[model samples]
Target chain A: MKLRSQTRVILPYLGILAVYALLMAVGVPWLVRRGQLAAAETGAGFNPTSLVIYVVVISVVGLFAGLYVNLRADARQRHALNQLTQATRDLGEGRFKELEIPEDVGPLPETQALKGALESTAREIQYRMEAILKEQSMLSAVLSQMTDGLLIADDNGRVLLLNKMAEKLFMISQEKALGRSVVEVMRHHALVELWEKFRGGESKSITLEMGVNRNFLQVVGIRLDDEIPGRSMLLFQDLTQTHRLEIVRRDFISNISHELRTPMASLKALSETLLDGALEDPPAARRFVVRMDTEVDNLSQLVNELLELSRIESGRTNFDFQRVFPCGLMAKACERMTLQAERMGLSVGQECPDNLPQIFADPARISQVFINLIHNAIKFTPAGGKIQLSAWQDGGFVVFRVADTGVGIAQKDVSRIFERFYKADRARAGGGTGLGLSICKHMVEAHGGKIWAESEEGNGANFFFTIPVAST
Target chain B: MARLTLDRELRLVQDEILILGSLVEQAILNAVDALRRRDIAAAMEVQHNDRRINNKRFAIENRILILLATQSPMAHDLRLLAGMLEVITELERIGDYAKGIAKVCVRLAEEDTLIPIREITTMADKAISMLHRALDAFIAEDEAAARQIPLEDDEVDELYNLVYHKLIQTMINDPQAIDHANQILWVIHNLERTADRVTNICERIVFIHTGELMEMDSEDDESEDEDENLDTA
Candidate 1:
């Protein structure tokens, strides 16, 4: 190819030189003859040696001119070829800069076309490279930002890629987890079993619950054959909160049924006794009526407590916010429970620094919380035991405590005491409605506060609640 | 080429060990949970799952034996397979303890006696936590963590003692409750033994790292002996 192109370039120069040579061959001798004729007419001699010298000098001059022009054209063509070679090298090495065709190359039309072709190829490659880079970054961004944990593993179960959420869910770092088997990384039998099943082609996708109780996760594994062959993708959705809510909901329904059924059974048995000739005995009938009245009263109390709890939980109960002094609130609660405490032979006391920060709370709801707590204390404590109410300031809130020298809650029941209808087995026997603490929890939280209890069985119990200090 | 096959086989064995470890862990957790909830059905399920744990252990043992016969791994790989053999045995024994607790749960369901379940649950928690960490140390080949984890066994022992005394007190207070109290005591005994087995697993971890077999509790025993000597003095 190179030889052929060089011949093409040289052929045009050769044609121009041949045409000039033919003109010289014909015209030079004729010019010499005319000189001879002119010399004879003027009675002078014409020399043949002079004619040969003249022909040789004119031919040498014409040949030199042709050689000079050909060399200059060849230099221009070589410069254009060098530029095209450099442009191709840069394109191969991924330097996508524009090809600079020199002005001297304007006469070489073939070289110009080659440079144009090189520039277009470089442009096409640059466009594709940019698009690929953009798509790669977009994929990584989406993977990192996803809420569900995403993991990609190869056919051999070695982890290939995992996003931030997946790393967090598995409590592993990407640097350490990559290229490790999924079974070794995850360490959950159920998950590994699912992976094995997916690998065996038993199922394309599988979902299973892994981890116990509070750390529950719903893991979904899918065979990923579209984007990358023989890889699996796992999506971990943490369901701990959902599981807890499900438990609470189930407990609520069961407890409500039990509470309703107990009183209804008693009412049914009492009416059945009345119908079986117990009404004919006047004094016995009066006793039965009083017992029926008490059962109905108990039922109504249960109903009212359930209604109140649901209302507060649903945020329908409007709290009338007030900046009440902490001591005043404690005193009012103690005063309300004083009569019952005295009847039970328990002494009620309130200890609060008068200078404590006032709390933002619904006065009535806050008082109800305090009264319910004290009532629980009076019920649980021995006849001579003391119930104390105290308050103090803790960062951004005023903390209130109701402590009692009573039979304390068991360790397991301490955390659950504030749950709706959750009664300690011991508390079940010595109970008002079990809704007191649950109501207290909701009311305190409605005031933008927190509530919790501390207890150990056979020792004493302390219930603490916090209300945000009224903004100055 | 043979070395590549050996490495792959070793990874497979490791995966099986982890699977077995998790099975034992879940069994322990479910058994104790069933006891606490008095769910006889869940207890029976845990009892049935013990066979699965046993099969897993045997399967791992068979794989280790095959690797030993075919690959004849040397030095560190040999120690790893040996340590894994010991670990799977210890894990299977722990699984049995879980089954024992499940049986106790079933027994308690038939009686009305109040068991001190809170202390028992705490003991199970401590033991299972120790076991979980020990397995992690084994997987990481961390000699430091393997050595440090056995110290927590003392906490489990202390809980065991607390429950033992509490059950004795229950028996002294009510003679008719002796059978139930003895059963509850057996549950704590199983838990204390589970923690001891976790210490054994930790020992194997250290062995895999340094090829030394020694009791992890020897230091605690020496400290106890000094305490006893001081008391006598």
Candidate 2:
């Protein structure tokens, strides 16, 4: 491509032609001036008039030979140029596999170096392109096959790229997702916050509670190589299980400590008192001993319940599941909780349609679930409040429900009523560890059933649990 | 030597893991005590005993890895090991944390009242206890308790945050107490990290086996301030 290098090759050929032309001009004249050199040779063969004519003829022949050599040099230059042009055209057409630059085109040293450099450049370019293709396919596969939701959005919150998982998670087709704002589709407040953080080119993760479900979105914002200033990607991962356990573990620790702390401290205090000779004072000793006994019983009960609840949750407990009449379980549950209901001056009543199909369940666990529900109703309901227990056959399942007329659960507390240690009134003391509803939930679930509650602050509350009917 | 397979020995493995988990938890408490008492000897004890913690971790880690390789374990086993990894990480962190506290102790060198370690000690104690209960739930496979651990961490956070502001106040009140106060703050920082770690352990437990997640950020939230704000508003 360089002009100077091209001139070096062309100049030599031009010089050779010039030298031939000079020989034809000056050398022929000298021979003619001599009037004898080639004339003598011609005269030897013929007369003086004939000799002059022969001399002229010899000079003409020499001139033709020089012209022929110059023509030959010009033809070779043309051939090289044509070859170069064809090779360049082929290279342009992307025939990368066979770019053969003719070695003879480099008549000069510099031109030879240029030819080698061009060949090496083409080879390197081919190698790099092949590598890029490989990388592109790998990236495409990864983007398509990944299970976790991936979203790459621009600085203005426009969704630029989304994977299959992302599409499924947002419930949108790819065409609908791209170029749309995240908020328009997801409408999740936490997601919006996450996007803003990402748009700022900051790496962060957010845990969001969507409706009743929990999820984790780990957004990794990297300033992309594009026009968008705050463009980044957000990866959505499902950490709901992990998140729930974390809450549970924390509550368990606090409850256990708070649970154990009271009794442990009491035990410690009682022992110290005994050590300080409180045992000598019979009345004080009696009270202290009685107190110690109560703490011991409470601790034992706590441990035992912890064990039982865990077994029920893990499906490790041997549940002799069977087809049981829902009315029977409800009756027994009320009978068990009757004394407590009476103490609270609340009536426990059941409603059931006769000839109800038998529901498959663990009888004891079902009874336990009902007892827990009624017990809670009795505890929270005011004296002289009414509690109704009912069952109905619906769609191959039996629905058991407890409805209470009392200080109803607040709208906020209603959602978390089933959570472990989720006491509506933490201030109200001397109740269980608040694991009752949680245990009831797990027990029901272990039987392949489900439970839920409905409540309003002023109006009374209703708790519903369902067990599927066993095939006859 | 008897060949111990994971599936056949799951219950036993779980019990052992819980025990080791509790010991590391107790170590976290001990480290907090080291700083609170300003006892170099106790700090040295925590630093020295950290090897024991690591040894326990390696044992658990080896078991988990072997189980994964040999047992062809399906869901629950997978979750248990995965949970164990998190628990081990928390334990390792607590051990490193103990060493960090020891380093602080050696630096402080018998200074009395140069720091405010009381609130931090309270927070760490709470965190340590939380770890124990989380482990207990794991052993019992008590989903309810497991789900509640994160809820408790929020309370720990509140306490640590309280200590955080108090330390800043102390430093402002007396510039001379700044160095000692910072050390106290560091311990509190470690305690808070420990609490967060315990929450991770809790999540692992539930994921191993349990119910669906119903809420987010149940990390020991007192809602004390929120309730007051609502009342005022």
Which candidate number has the best TM-score?
1
lDDT of 1 at A309: 90
lDDT of each: 0.84, 0.72
Fnat of each candidate: 0.62, 0.00
Q: For model 2 chain B, where is the 10-residue window of minimal lDDT?
A: B224-233
- Mind giving the per-residue lDDT tens digits that candidate 1 earns over A1-472? 5567667667766876787688677867787888789888987877567667766876787677778878888787787788778777877877665645344453555776777777688778889989998999999999999888888899989999999988887778999899989987888888888888877765544444443333667777788787778998888887778887987788778878988888899899999999999999999999999999999999898889889998998999988897889898889878988999999999888889978987888889999999889988887888899998999998999999999999999777898899777778643444467898999999988888999999988887999999999999
Chain B of model 1: TM-score? 0.92
- What does chain B score (TM) in every candidate? 0.92, 0.82
lDDT of candidate model 2 versus the reference:
0.72
DockQ scores of all models, one per candidate: 0.47, 0.01
Q: Please estimate how well model 1 matches the true structure, expressed as its whole-model Cα lDDT.
A: 0.84
What is the TM-score of chain A, computed separately for every candidate? Answer: 0.74, 0.58
Give me candidate 1's TM-score against the actual structure: 0.78
Per residue, candidate 2 scores C-alpha lDDT tens digits across A156-227 of 667888898888766568997787566544545446656677567566776554421224444444556466
